[model samples]
Target: MNSRKKMRGGPKKFKKLELYSRISFLYLNKAFKNPLILKVAERKHKLVFKFLEKEQADVIAKYKNLKEKKHDEVGVRYIWTLWWQGEDLAPEVVKLCLNQLKENSNGAKVVLITKDNYKDYIELPPYILEKREKGYITFQQLSDIIRFTLLEKYGGLWLDSTIYTSKPIPKEYFDYPFFSQHTKWADTCFVQHNLWHGFCIGSKKGGKLVSFAKEMFFDYWENHDVIVDYLMIDYILMIAYNHFNDIKEEIDSLPYSSERLYELVTILNNEYDEKYFNSLMEECIFSKLDWHKEYKLSIKGKETYYSHIVNLQ
Candidate 1:
C-alpha cells in the first residue's frame, strides 16, 4: 500500500466559499431543472464576458498578431510534470506514474518541475508570486500557471503528475500545434464551449492557445487577489476557445483521443487480469490515477489492478 500523504493545496476561506457555492448551484441545477436557475447562470456568464471585455483589447490583439510555427519546427521535445515536494517525496502512485512517463517518453525529455527548481525553468510575474506567497493562490493554481507558461516558451506536453502511461505517447499528438484530450465526458458550466482536458495539454512553442491562456492567467491574478473559482484555468481555456478563432480552429482540427484516460480508476479494485488489462491499454495509452485515495496492494491474496499498475515495469 502507498503510505505517503496527498496534499490538496486548496484555496483559502473566501475562495473555498466561492467555489463551494458554485458547486452547490451546479448540483441544484441538475437536481431540479429550473429555468430561472439556468437564466441566472447565463447572466453570470455574461457578466464574466463583460468583465473580460475590458481587458480584451490588448490580449486579443496580441493573440491575433502572434506568429504561428509548423509542428516539426517546435514538436513535443519535452514532457513536463510537477510534484512540488520532488519525486522522492511524492506518493508511491505518483512515483510510479513518473516512471511510466519516462519509460514511454518516446525519446522526449521528461522534466519533473519541483518547487525548489521551478524558477530555473520559467519566471512568473511579481503579482502571481506575491499571491502564492500570501496563500491567495494554491499550489494547484500555481501549477496551472507554470503549465501554460512552460508550454508557451517551450513546446511540449503537460501531463498532470497522476497520469500513468501504458505505451509511448502517440506520434499524432506531436503533429498538431496545440492538442488536448477533447473528451465529451468533461463536465463544466461551459460544457458546450469547452471540451478540452487541462490535465493533458500539448502545445507548440508560442502556440496561440497557450499564449492566450498565459495572458488570461497573468491578467486575472493581477486584477484579483482572491480566486473566483477552483477551475479558473479551465474557465479561461473555454473563454479563449470562444473568443479566439485560431485557437478554436486548432482545437477542432485534432482527432478524438484519450477516450478511456480515466477508465482504470473505476476498476482499480478489480482482480488483475492480463487479458482485461490489455483491452484497457487498447482504449488509451494513458490512465489517470488518484494518489489521494487509499488503494490496497492486494485483495483476498490476489493483486488488484491498482497494485499491478503501480508496480508495472
Candidate 2:
C-alpha cells in the first residue's frame, strides 16, 4: 500500500480531513492576513473578544493610572507578549500593563508577533512599542527575541497583555538559585518555578520544553500560537534549571511552594528510600503546587514604590 494509504488505514481518511478543516478555519479567521478570509473564517475569533473584555475589565477596575510618562526612572522591565488575535488586545493591554508598571515604578515594552495591521489598530505609550517586525517567524522565533531582549536589555520579565499585576515582583523573588552565565538554562529554570507557582503555562523550561507544546497555528496559518508566546520565556526557564544544577539553587532559595517541594523531595529522596520518593511523587500529583496563589499572596498588599504612582492623575 502507498504511504498515504497506509497512514489513512488506521484512522479514516475523512477524519484527518475534518481535523485539518477545523484547524484551517481557526487559522484563516484568527491568524491569517487576508481581510477577505476573516469575513469567511470561523467563530473562534469571538474567543478573542471574550478574552479582551474579561482581561481589560479586570485591569481597568483594579488598577489606577498615574501621570502619562515617557519612562520609569527606577528601571524595572515589563515586557508584553502578543500573537495575532492578541493584537486586538494590544492597546488595552499596553494601557493596563503601563498602569501596573507605573503603579510599580517600572519601564514597559511590547513584543508583537504577526503580519497584521497592529500598527493601525493600536496606540501605545512612548515606552512601549513592538520589538520585532512581523515576518515568517515561528512562536519559537518570537520567544527568542523576548528572552534576548529581557536578558540583554530589559531584565527578564515579559508581562502578558492578559496578566495584570496588582503588586510588584521584586528582584528578591529571583534571588534564590545562583545566577548563571548560561542564559538559556537560567531563563528556563526560572520559568519552571514561575509556572509551578502559576506565573506561566507549561511545566518545562527553555526551548526544549517549548518544543513540546502542540502548534496551535498549524490549523490556521495566520493564527500562530499566541499562547505559546506567553509561555515561551517560562519554558526557557525550565530548560535552564534542568541543565544547570547551580542555577536551580537560585530558584531553590525562593520562598515558594515549589521551592519547598524541591527541598522536601531532596531530603526525602536522599535520606529515605526510592519507595518514599515514589510516594511523594504520587502525593505531588494529587495535591499539585499552586504557585499563582502563593506568588499573589507573597506580593499582596506590599507597598511597592509604584503604589503611589498608580494613583497619579
Candidate 3:
C-alpha cells in the first residue's frame, strides 16, 4: 500500500507547471527590459532602415509598451530573425523594440540574425549590425535556426520567433530534462534534419545527446527507412526512451492523457488516414482517439502520404 501511494504521488508531483513558471518569469522579465530590435544591415556595411510598415509599427509599439508594464520581472536577451523578404516592417519593429528596451531599468540586448547577400533593402541604425550570416531560408526555417542558435550562444532557457513571445516560460515546457525526457515515450516522432529541427527543450549537454540521436536515427532510416518512414525529433526521442531505462521510467511516471490528441483532431480537418493516425498514437503515446489528418505528427500519414504518391492535386 505504501509503495502504491508513493508511485501515485510521484508522477503528479513532477511540477511541470512550476518549472514553466520560473522559466516564464525569467523570459517575461527579459522582455520587459529588453524588447528585440529588428534591423537590416547591408553587404557593403551600408545600413538601410524602414522595414515595418507604418501600420504594423504602431501596433508593435503599443504591444511593446504594454508588455513592458505587464512583464517587469528580470532582465533577458531578446533576438529575432528576419528574412530579407519581410523588408517592409523590419525597421519599424526594430525601433519599437529598442524604445521599449530603453524604457526598462535592466536594459535589454536586441539583435538580428540575417542572411548575407540581401542586405541593401533596408537601412540599419548604428546599434544594429550585419552579424551571424547564414544561408537563405524561409521565415519558418529561419525561426527554427535562430531559436537553437540563441540557445547555444546565450545559454537562454527558451527562444521564440518575432511573431511570438513566451512571457513567462511555462513550466510544462521545461518539464523534461534532455536525455531522460526524450527517452520517456514509446513512439517515433519526426523532426527535420536541419540544425534547429529536433528536441525543442534541451541544455547544452542535451545538445550532444541530440547529435547522437540524430546520427542513430539517420543510420536506422538508411537501412530500414520504410519500416519507420520518416524520423521526427519526438519519435527519435521515443526510440531513445526505449533504449535508455532512465528516460523510459521518468516518462512512464508522468501524467498523460489520450484525450488531448482527440481534442486536437476534432479541431483539425480530415486529411489523415485512420491507419496512420493510429500509428501516430502508438508511436507518440497518445491515449485518445481524437486524431486529425491535417495536423503535423511524427510520421507522414493520410494527407502527407497521399500528397506524395498520388499527387492528389
List the RMSD of every prediction in angstroms: 7.5, 19.2, 23.8
Off by over 4 Å in 3: 1-113, 116-166, 170-176, 179-200, 204-208, 214-231, 249-313
**Candidate models: Cα lDDT each:** 0.76, 0.33, 0.31
Candidate with top lDDT is 1
TM-score of 1: 0.83
* lDDT (Cα) of model 3: 0.31
- Per-model tally of clashing residue pairs: 0, 28, 37
Candidate 3 lDDT over residue span 115-143, tens digit each:
55323323332111211122112244334
Please, what are the lDDT tens digits per residue for candidate 1 over residues 84-152? 999999998899889999999988989999989989989999979988998978888999999999998
* Comparing 1 and 2 on lDDT, the stronger one: 1
In candidate 2, position 193 carries an lDDT of: 23
Residue by residue across 1-313, what tens digits does model 2's lDDT show? Answer: 2121112122342343344335534553245544444443223333332333332333222222211122233243333344454544445334444455445533344344343643452332221222123333444454444333333333334334334343444443222212221212111112232333322221111212222121211111122212322333334344434444433554454333322233331231122334554455443311222112211211244532223222332
Q: Give the TM-score ranking, best first.
A: 1, 2, 3
